[model samples]
Every structure is written in structure tokens, then in C-alpha cells.
Target: MRPPCDPSKFVAEIVKNVPPSGIRRFFDLVSGLEDVISLGVGEPDFITPWHIREMCIHSLEKGQTSYTSNYGLPELRDELSRTYYRRYGLDYDPASEILVTTGVSEAIDIALRAVVNPGDEVIVVQPAYVAYVPAVVLAGGKPVIVSTHRDDEFRLTAEVLKPAITSKTRAIVLNFPNNPTGAIMTREDLEDIADLVAEHDLLVISDEVYECLTYEGKHIPFSSLEGMKERTVMLNGFSKAYAMTGMRLGFAMAAPEIIRSMMMIHQYSMLCAPITAQIGALEALRNGNDEMERMVREYDRRRHFIVRGFNRIGLDCFTPKGAFYAFPYVGATGLSSSEFSERLLNEKRVVAIPGDVFGEAGEGFLRCAYAASMDDLKKAIDRMDEFVGGL
Candidate 1:
């Protein structure tokens, strides 16, 4: 008889060493509970717009179920080409310059893999989305973490970013409006870093999935900066804006060569995004703006409400001008982020992600997502106040 196989040994040591996502453990806790107000998952509360869903259904009804080109549906890419030019004044060739992936997450992963050789250092700003660092490591790149501060509204200014770049630096990841903190980098702010990126001849993986939800001045594409377009891979998706998280459709726009490389990895790995999801995404790009804007207005309203609620209860929360999260400093409570989050879940039935999961800098903070019903937001705040009072 053949010896019992040890499939577990096939897992690389580095893969085994990578910690599980900090955001998911709380989600796991929330899943088993009843009457819990969760402020953890960074997803919109709105359902996918009716038209978008209708398009997906219509496509399936028409028997359009086969896999699309690895580069994604040409129609979607053509729409994307027109849309990017119209929205950002940046033109992308639909045939050679765009690649649709399973989601923005996959785009990020593939972009890193395509450009990052083993041991190359990729600058990752923190507190960042949970996936960024691990993605860098798995891509065989060393993650050089750059921490942004609350005083700067968590914007990664050139001053903080300069020190992180080294001779081995290969690329950098940019996300704004940022996750957890809801940070927005102004045009001048991006220009500051753009200069450094151009100076160093580095690459940028700009994750603009949250771009449409920006409530501040217009969102500027980092690729629009002079001399930066060729070095930038812009990742965006329908998940956040159209509330199509389940669809998992996202695209990357980049120089022809960069896009081709990413497409190679995507073709072999994911093959193509789901046909139905791409259909829904096509509808979103075509006509989902009205519903998207309506949802943004609601999120903006909740944004102000939740920030005010946290501030009123003595948690110092910076007003986030974009995205749907409020990062509140819970250090005054003398509880570590994990301690505070766990106790809040156990005693108060309120769920919040601990800042420590975002990175070490995220310690002593709680990321409370406002993408929930106002009723739930209010109740969660009350419970938080009670929890802190008892502490």
C-alpha cells in the first residue's frame, strides 16, 4: 500500500507563517450571534442595483454562460476604455491596456506578482486593508510598511514615504479613500508622492476601488499625474459603488506591457471573472450611476451620524470624508484593540474590528463601519458608550 500522503507538507513555510486576516475573526464571531450590530465588514449595505442584477439575469437567460476572453469581455473593456476617458480624462486602449480580473483583490495580487520579483521591496502604507502585506509576501516581495498618522489624517505624505523607499524598492501600493480609516489623499498630496515615485522610477498599484464613494473634491487618478501613467496599475471594481460584492468583478488599467503580464497570470489562475458578474459589471459601467450616487448619499449621511455618535460618547474619531468607516481611538479605555473589540462583542452585542489587525499602528483604535442601518448605528453607539462606561 502507498504510504499515507502528507498534503500539508506541500504548504510552503512562508504560506504557513502568514497570519490569518485580522478582519475575518470578528466576522466569524459575529456570524454565530443573534441581534448583533456588526461594524466590521467593509461592505456597503445597499443591494446591487436592480438594473445591474437584471442585466446579469438577462445575460444568463440569453445563454451567455460561456467563459469570456481572459482579458474579459471586449464589450466591457470597450465600455471601460470610454468610461475612464470620460471620467478621468485618461484614455486606455481596450484591447491592450485593460485586464479584468475576479475582483480588485485579484488585480492587486496579480499586479504585485507581475512586477515584484523575489526579495524586491514593495512599500505598503498602514493602517491598510488586511490583504496588502500578505499579498506582497505571497508574491515573493518583501513588504516595506509605511505607517500614516492620525495627525495627517492618515495620508501617506512623501515625508513618511521617503524613508521607506530603498535601493531594493520595486513598487508601492496606494489606496484612497482608504479602508478602516476612510482617508483621502488630495491632488496636491498625491502629487507630492508622485514626484518621489517618478524620481525613483518605481511602480504603483493604485487600488481605487473606493474612488466613486469619495465625498471630498473629485477623485484624481494617480495615473493621471505627469509621467506616472506608465508606471501605474489602476485597480477598480463594481463591488463598492454598485454594492455588487458578491459579483467579484474588477478591472485593471495599465500600460500595455504591464497589463499583458497581469493578464498572463490571470488567464492561468482565475481564467476569467464570472460571466454573470461581468455582465452585471457591464450594466454598472453603462447605467448604474444614479443608484450608486443614491447609495453614496446615504453612506455620507451615515458617515456624519456615526462620526458624531462616536465623538459624542468620548471616542475620538476623525471625520472621514470618504469610504464608510469611522476609526475611533479606544486607547483612553486602557484596553488593547483586541480586548475592546472582544468585550464589546461579548458584553454589548456590538461588533467592531480592532485596529491592531490593520497593522501595529492600528492598535488602540476601533474601525466601525457606518455601512449599516441608522437604527443599528444608533444602537451600537449606545452599547459602545455603555461598554466604555463600564470599562
Candidate 2:
């Protein structure tokens, strides 16, 4: 008989330090509760538009069910290339510089794995998406977090970036129209980052999945900077903008050499994104802009409703300029982020993610995703107001 396996031997050392994603726990807990209003998940509540859905069905009916090229279908790549150029004024060779991945999440993973070596240092701005640190660790790198203050709109400045850099630094992971915080980087901010990155020769793994969601200003691609194109790996997707999150279609754009290496990883890891998703993404790029704009406008309206509601209820929320989240300070409640969320959930049936779930910098706050119906938003506000008033 084979010897009994040791449980300790089965788990990797890296897995021990990485905590479970805090975002997922709230999602799982809320999903089981009946009549619970959830603003926990940072996903567009809208359905994939009819035309985009039709494209996927049409492709499936046409027997386009087989695996695509590991780099992705050429048609999708061509359209995505055109879309990026048209929208951001950044030129990328579809054939040599783009690799379609399962989602922007996967693109981030691929980029991290492709560039980072053991003990390499990657600078991450927090409060950020939960995936960045773990992705770095899985790539055999150390994540050096730079805390961005809520008071400053969560902008990651060169001042913060300076101390995080050392000789071991390999890259900086930038996720703007940031998760939880909803902050965006301006052109001036990108220019400053370009100067530092150029001096340090640092690679920028830019996650711009929420590019289309900015409310106050235009989305500026970090890759659009003069000296940044060759150094930036852009991660974009059909999820938030097209409401195609379930389709799991996203792509990465980088220099030819970087794309070649990422393609090799993609070939071994995922092979390719679903052929159906590729088709849907292609149609989304071709025709989904108008739909995206409509949704963005809707989100903007909902954003104001949520923020103004919170203010009226005595919970002062910082109005977000990008993404569909509002980070509100919950200090008056005399509860920690987790405590406040739990109390609100049990007492009011209103579910929102605790900001600390994003990182320590996210403490003293709560993240409310404004991706629900207006009625739902109003109901949630009422519930929260009642709960807070009793405090």
C-alpha cells in the first residue's frame, strides 16, 4: 500500500501567506440570502447587449466551436487593435502585439508570469484589486504595496512610487479606474509615471478594464505616452463596457516581444479564450460602443443617486470619478469595515463590500457598487439610513 500522503507536503508555501480573496466571501455569503440587495460584486448588472449575444449564437451556429489560435482569432485581434487606436490614439500591431485572454484578470496573470522572476519586486498601488499581490507571488515575485490616500482621490503619485522602488523592482501594476476606490490617472499623472518608469526601466502592467466607465474625464491610456508604449502592457476587456462579464473575453496589448512571450504562456495555460467569446468580443468592438455609452450614462445617473443618498443619510461618501463604486467613510458608526458590513447585512438586508477587503489602506471605509436598479438603490439607501439613524 502507498504511504499516506502528508497534508503539509501538498500545499505550496506561497499559498499559506495569501489570504482568501475577501471580495469573494461577501459575494458567496450574499448570494445565498433571499431578498438581500447586494452591491458587493464589481460587475455590470446589465446583460450582454442583444446584438453582441446574437453574434455569439451566430458563430456557434456556423460551427465556429473549435479552438482558436492561442493568440486569438485574427478578426477579433484586428478589431480590438482598431478599437484601441481609435479610442486611445495608441497604435498596436494586432498580429504581433495583442493576445486575447480569458479576461483582463487572466491578462494580468499572464503579464506577471511572463516578466517576474523569483524575488523580483513589483509595486502595487492600494487600495487595489485583490488579484495583484497574489498574482505577483505566484509569479515568484514580492509585491511592494504603495498606499494611495483616500483624501487625494487615491492617485498613485511619483512620491509614493519612489520609496517602493529598488534595484530588485521589476514592474508596477497599475489598475486605474481603480477597483473599490474608483480613481483614475490623468495625462499629467501618466507623464510623471512615464518619467519615473523610463528612468527605472520599469515595466507597467496596466489594468484598464474600467476604461469606459470614467464619469468626470476621458480615459487616458498609459500606453499612449511618448516613451511608455514599449514599456506598458495594457489589459482591457469586453466585460464592464459590453456587460459581457460571463463571456470571459479580454486581451492584452504590448510590444511584439512581450506578446510573443505571453502567447507562449497562453498556449500552455488556457490555449485560447472560447471561440464563441472571441466572436462576441469582435462584435462588441465593432458595434458595442453605443451600447457602452448608454450604460455609462445610466451608471453615472445611478452614481449620483447613490452618493447623494449616502450624503443625505449622514454617511459622507467620496464621489467617484470612474468605475461604478463609491467608497464611503463609515467612521461614525464606531465599527470596523467588516463589523459595519456584517451589522448592515444582518439588520438592514443591505449588502456592500467592506473597503478593508481591498487592502489595509481601505480601512475605515465601505465600497458600494452602483450597478443595481434605481429602485434597489433607493431601497438600500432607506435601509442603511434607518440602520444608521438608530446608531
Using lDDT, give the best candidate's number: 1
Q: Which ten residues in a row have the lowest lDDT in candidate 1?
A: 22-31
What lDDT score is found at residue 71 in candidate 2? Answer: 93
How do the residues 185-225 of candidate 1 rate in per-residue lDDT, one tens digit apiece?
A: 98888999999999998999999999998987888889999
> Candidate 2, residues 84-115: lDDT per residue as tens digits?
77887788898999999998989999899999
What is the TM-score of candidate 1? 0.97
Each candidate's TM vs. the true structure? 0.97, 0.97
Q: Which regions of candidate 2 fall more than 4 Å away from where they truly are?
A: 6-8, 24-28
The window of 10 residues in a row where model 2 has the poorest summed lDDT is 23-32
| lDDT (Cα atoms) of all candidates against the true structure | 0.91, 0.90
